[model samples]
Target chain A: MTITLQEVLPTYFEESRRHQSEIWGKQLTFNKGEYIKIVAPSGSGKSSLTHFLYGLRNEYNGKLLYNGQDLHGYSVEDFARYRKDHVSIVFQDLRLFPEQSVRDNLELKRQLNPYHGPEKITEMAERLGIGSKLSVKSRICSYGEQQRVAIIRALLQPFDFLLLDEPFSHLDDNNSKKAMELMLEEAAARGAGILFADLERIDFFPWQRLYHL
Target chain B: MALSFQPIKPLLQTGTNAASRWFSYIGLGIGVLLLLCSIQMYINIQQLLGGDSPRKDGHDFISISKTITDETMGQLEKNLFTEADIKDLEGKPFVSGVSPLLANNFRFQLSGGSLVPFVTDFFVESLDDTFIDTVPPTFHWQEGDEVVPIIIASDFLEIYNVFAPSYGLPQISESTATNLGLQLICYYPDGNRATFRGRVVALSDRINSIIVPKTFLNWANQRFATTKELRASRLYVKTKDANSPDFLNYLTEKHYKVNKDKTKFGRVKQVLQGIFSGLGIFGLLVVILALMLFSFYLQLMIARSKDNLQLLLMLGYSPNWLSTNVARRFIPVYILVVLFAVAATQLMQWAFHHFAMYDREELTTWLHWSVFATAGFLIALSLFTNYRMVKRLLYRMA
Candidate 1:
């Protein structure tokens, strides 16, 4: 699937802010099975960009096209289906249910499809170095561990595109590398694309294209 | 990715311990209690107004007589109800049947054998068999039958019990009175006398006079009366509704005297019916209010759990699925409440039957089938309403 953004400007940004930016009010397209990095400074609407693509926030100008169809035209149920079947996101805040155990959070995503199983969750958790923390409540886990859990949760579902809004901000280099390696392995196996957002570019993977905001 | 997770239990347990929900439960319990109590009380009052008589013939049969006055007493023939009067009463819209009470012209002497051999003259009045309340299977008597079935007024026993002790006579029980044998001798005007054994078959509160089978009375009157035709003094009018204003007005306009005791009973039944109807309306209002309160509580809970629900929705769970998870939590509570309410009502009914019921023999059970039907209706209504409310809230949130 291809997501095309035509002159997209968040409603929260002031008119002067849009004029000060190059990414806003510009036509851009993220294609399938392509690794792209959205590099931006702090307060440049990276999270807003990710939220718009994930169908979470709709208060933005411009027409977002998913495979040539207007994203605004999709009903709530249609958007839900699109999110479940095509787009997966690891939010900057890592919206994991605090009261649920880490395993439950992962299982909530994994159980949406028949191919993903508990063994896969365990394997991913072990690789992410939070295997032992899987049974602990997400509220009690460290921010880095919770971020790994959220990454594993997002990867559990089948998606055509993975949206990473500073997904490894709390993780150290090694943990971030491990998380990125696992994400690449899963995305490669499913022939999926990745949209990674960060303040600065890191030499984690060879990006086919990079955009600066 | 297979969505094989059983999120229902965990989701339900997450918000299961809301203390405010107890208010809804208590409200429901109170509503159910009021409804069940009203049902029970209505049934009890019905049994009470019906009295000890198992048959409901009293409502259909009205005893009417010509209004007695000094002028009519001086004119003896005017006191007796003519054939025209009977026809006029029978022509009324509410009147289904009309039967006149026939008095036996022959003199009958009743002697209690051996126990108390005091002889007394007794008058026998007979009406149509349809008007009699409790007719025994052996009430019919043939000419050759040795025993004659007699039904005595229940008030006669009450009066006898009141005065017999003062006169140093034994106050007999119903069974003893029924078993007591009496030798009946009929004295004809031509000096011919015939003897028959008499036994009390039943007791009647509706009929004021000593009653014999109409067939037996007809035969006895034919065999012993001096004249072929005898005018009736009292009439039994069967009406659809004894408490109808038109019937009462007609009775008043015609200057007919109705049995004050039975009419008072009819009035009491009407008043009791009104009371029960009012209680039923109140109970319904309480149940409706309780339902609204419960729905409001459910809405509040769903709102409180909005974040969890939205997270679930983001995970591809349909609003309907999440709504069902929320609704399932209340299913067990509702079932238990209904079960407990019905059980409590049944217990109350049991206590009423064993201790509170006046005529235990008349009503076999205190728990009427309507109670279960009403409970079932309530359960269905509450569950359906709750389910719908939960779904509506979830859909609105979606």
Candidate 2:
């Protein structure tokens, strides 16, 4: 799967800001099994760019093509199918259901694709140092724990591309490194690509290509 | 890897407000009950007005007489109806048929051991056999037959009961009076005498005089009368509709007196039917309003659950799928409401049958097919309306 952007400019962003960014009014293509990093300063529409790619935001100028098909022509059901089978996202806000436990949060997405099971979730939770918190409600968990839970939930479904929007903002350096390694291993095993957005680059993970948003 | 992929249960309970749901159910149930009862009452009134078992004379026939005045009272023979009067009555558009009543002129004495052992004069009147109700096969007399079959007026029994106590005579029951045989002695004006046995065959509330068979009257009147020409004092007029304005107006214009007691009673029945029909319509209106209120309540609940529904949609569930989940919650309530409403109607019908109309044999059932059909129609309408409302709300949210 590949996503191609041609001179894409979000409608909400000021036109003057486009001159400062390399991605604005520039053609970019993301291919399968490639890790790309979007590095930008604060207030640079990193979340907007992720939402646009995930079909959540459409108020943008220029055309977005998904595997040679125009994104604008896709119906709601088509978008839903795309999200279920091809693309997965870890939202910046980590939209976890407050009433459900971490396991329930992870199980909700896992139910859509049955390739992964509870043992995989437990192994990932143990590796992330949040195994004991899986049975507890997501609302009572710490921000870092919730972020880790969201990461596990996003990875539960089969996807060609994983979109991450400042997913490691609440984590410490050591935990972020651990989470990155876990994500890299999963993506490598599935032969999927990763689009990570952040304010700064981390030295531990190497990216095949870097774009300034 | 044993990942448990259970879809999360909804956080907000969609059981609905029990009190409000039940309140709506009760309101609807009462509406249904009122509708059923009104239909039952309307049927009962219809039976009373038109049923053949209770009314001795059908609504089609009416007995009429000329109005008595001082001049006509002084000359009673002048008031007697001739063949011209019968022909005139039959010529009217409303009058289907007319039969003149015949009266016995000879004196007759009735002597029975059990009751009425008097030797006074008794008068007998007769009309066409078709005008009488419940005519026995033996009412016709052969040449050798001496027993006479008579039909006495039911009001005559009431009058006799009222006067018997004062006259120091025993008041007899209907069964005993029917069984008592009386010997009749006819005294002719020429001093000839004859004897015959008499038996009461039937009783009638419509006919106000003693009724004998037309065959016997013609046979007896031929042998005993001084003249051959027969003049009737009363005539039974069969009209298409007794309450028709034209018939009443014609009777009034001719100064003829008709028995309007049955027609008046029929009018009262029609008024009852109108009132019950109005009440039934009111009940149906209440049911419609209650259903609207219930639909509004469901819309509110769906609105309250909008966030969760949208979240489910975002998780790749179709809007129709979510709507089905919401609709499933109310299906039981809908079934229960219909069942309860129908059950309450049936219970009311049972109570009416065993209690309210216990003595009325003509009213056999309070539950009519129309009642069930109406209730079924209302239930289906409510369920369909509710389902459509839910689907519309879900689609809008989507």
TM-score, first chain, each model? 0.96, 0.97
In Å, residue B391's CA in model 2 sits off its true spot by 3.9
lDDT by residue for model 2 (B309-389), tens: 666556555555555556666667666766677677777767776788784777665467777787778777777777777
Best lDDT among the predictions, by candidate number:
1
| Alpha-carbon deviation at B314 in model 1, angstroms | 2.9
Q: Is the docking of candidate 1 incorrect, acceptable, medium or high quality?
A: acceptable
Interface RMSD of each: 2.0, 3.5
Question: For each candidate, what's the DockQ?
Answer: 0.34, 0.21
The docking quality of candidate 2, as DockQ, is 0.21
Superposed on the true chain A, the predicted chain A of model 1 yields a TM-score of: 0.96
Second chain only: TM-score per model? 0.56, 0.53
Considering summed lDDT, which 10 consecutive residues are worst modelled in model 2 chain B?
Answer: B1-10
Q: RMSD in angstroms, all models?
A: 9.3, 9.8
Q: Model 2, which residues run further than 4 Å from truth? A: A4-7, A16-34, A65-79, A188-191, A203-207, B1-9, B13-22, B28-273, B292-304, B359-380
Evaluate model 2: give its lDDT.
0.77
Cα TM-score of candidate 2 = 0.61
What lDDT would each prediction earn against the true structure? 0.80, 0.77
